[model samples]
Target: MDFSLQQIWEHTGLFARFIIFTLGFMSMSSLIVIAERMVVFRKTRSDSRNFASKMGAILAKGDLSTAANTNLGKDVGHLGRVINSGLTAYRISPNDKDVAVESVARALERQAQREVQSMKRGLGVLATVGSTAPFVGLLGTTMGIVNAFQEMAKSGAGGLATISAGIAEALITTAFGLLVAIPAVMAYNFLQGWVDARSVDISESSNEFLDVVARNLTGGETRSQQQAG
Candidate 1:
């Protein structure tokens, strides 16, 4: 069997060709998701770094009022969005320290979850491709083998050599399936790891932000009482 991919492809039946095309589409979908997620993560990380640098000083000073309702000037990233949510909550709530602090805490928690979920967008597609591609290819191979046997029976031939070419063509889909699956699984794992790392970062930042908000609110109330006294 002097078989190249092109030769095998040319000889493949309609169903085998359809399976190949399906696998090809799956491969493309996974690649597109991986690339899109990579770009989004990179851009968002850059924006986060910039936001932290610009806002860190004010936040560290526990000047919640100063940082509240800040103008982002552009689409902000994860840290920016979470922090802004807390600040907006703080600013909008009434002057009760406990109530305001509680509001900010809740806002931070919700926004952090939202950011993590946003970061995780498109990962489902990667996971689906990784898990399903092999099965899809297997389906193609099974169908191909069944067809191959039918052909042999029709021709009244009985031997492995007689059906070798058909079997080889059928196995090609399995090979292609493996090829598509391996990279998708690897990419999914890699991107999932990145999301986990960012989740940790968000958790830490949210904690720190809550601490700052609580202290600032408490201090403001104490000062107001002292001045009144």
Candidate 2:
């Protein structure tokens, strides 16, 4: 290669490709987050609707098996899983309804935390790409500029044409990098917010379900017993 501006562009293109790769991965991460959120939404909605109805019925009839299986069958989402965990725990110690409800709530809370962690998977990578991709592109741009300046020094040409190619390469690389980074950054932020909100919803719903279970199990029995004693 004569090491001209065109040569520099060719090399810059390769660097641009690297930026592209980073952006592509970032896009995939965003998509994954979106998919997870969608799944969570659907499952949470289904769980909330069905859980209350089924649980109420099960509790009314004192059918622990159906209630327990309802929890198992719910694909409502992470929150459902948490609710199910609590319900199952309660089922295991049906005699101590108060203690069982409390134990299930704790277990469900822990499971909810884990599910929240799972929902956050790959988010860090997206954030890293969004925050650092531009810098990576700038690195390539800087390299291209250096090469251009070197050519200028060697050519001893004092015209815009002499450096135009190099300048183009530099600008192109930088622009491409920004293009890659901006969307990745945006998606990362959007998805992060969505994930946090989803987790909150899960926690709230799980807690509410725990309350329902507690109320059903105790049913003023504890209060009446304490008053009697």
Candidate 3:
């Protein structure tokens, strides 16, 4: 018995159709997230690089005030925000070296956490779709097999023709599930890697900024103590 795609779709039972619809929805959602994240990640990377280059020269001159103010600008990214937090803390309590260092460290940590959280938005959905889509499809397959057996029982004829429709539905739904799941899993991995790389860059930049602040603060303290002596 030959069956066309249209014939198979028309014959697909309610449960199998529902599973296919669910898979379609998941795929669409994953695609949306992938597109949105790609744009955001690209812009963040570009902005961070620009911010780092501009601030690097300023920090070399021991200009904490300028560095702190740069973060408020529209062009700054995560690295700038982290650096701004620490610099703002230091500027507020320049003479209290211990307090300033502690404050800046805390600020950097907080900002890093916030940035990571922001980057992780929508990833949970992707992960859920990647992990559960196959199982959902499998459920459809199970339902299809049951339906095929039921049809065989009803017809009283033991032949492939009696069960072909159910089998086709089962295969179609399973294929659709894999189609949705494979791309979703690949996208999740790629986006996760991008997030990790961005995080590393932010961490390294924060550390460099902290080192510059520490040196300037320590030098100022040394000069003050020598003057007192």
Off by over 4 Å in 3: none
Off by over 4 Å in 1: none
**Candidates by TM-score, descending order:** 1, 3, 2
Tens-place lDDT per residue, model 2, 129-206, is 678768877876787778788899999986777877767777666776677778767766876787788688777867
TM per candidate: 0.96, 0.75, 0.95
For model 2 the local lDDT of residue 72 reads 42
Quickly count the clashes in candidate 3.
Answer: 0
Whole-model Cα lDDT of every candidate shown, in order: 0.90, 0.70, 0.85
What does candidate 3 score in Cα RMSD to the true structure?
Answer: 1.5
Expressed as tens digits, the lDDT of each residue in 160-223 for candidate 1 is 9778879988999999999999999999999999999999998899889989877887888899
Alpha-carbon deviation at 153 in model 1, angstroms: 1.1
TM-score of model 2 (CA atoms): 0.75
Q: What is the lDDT of candidate 2?
A: 0.70
Q: How many clashes would you count in candidate 1?
A: 0
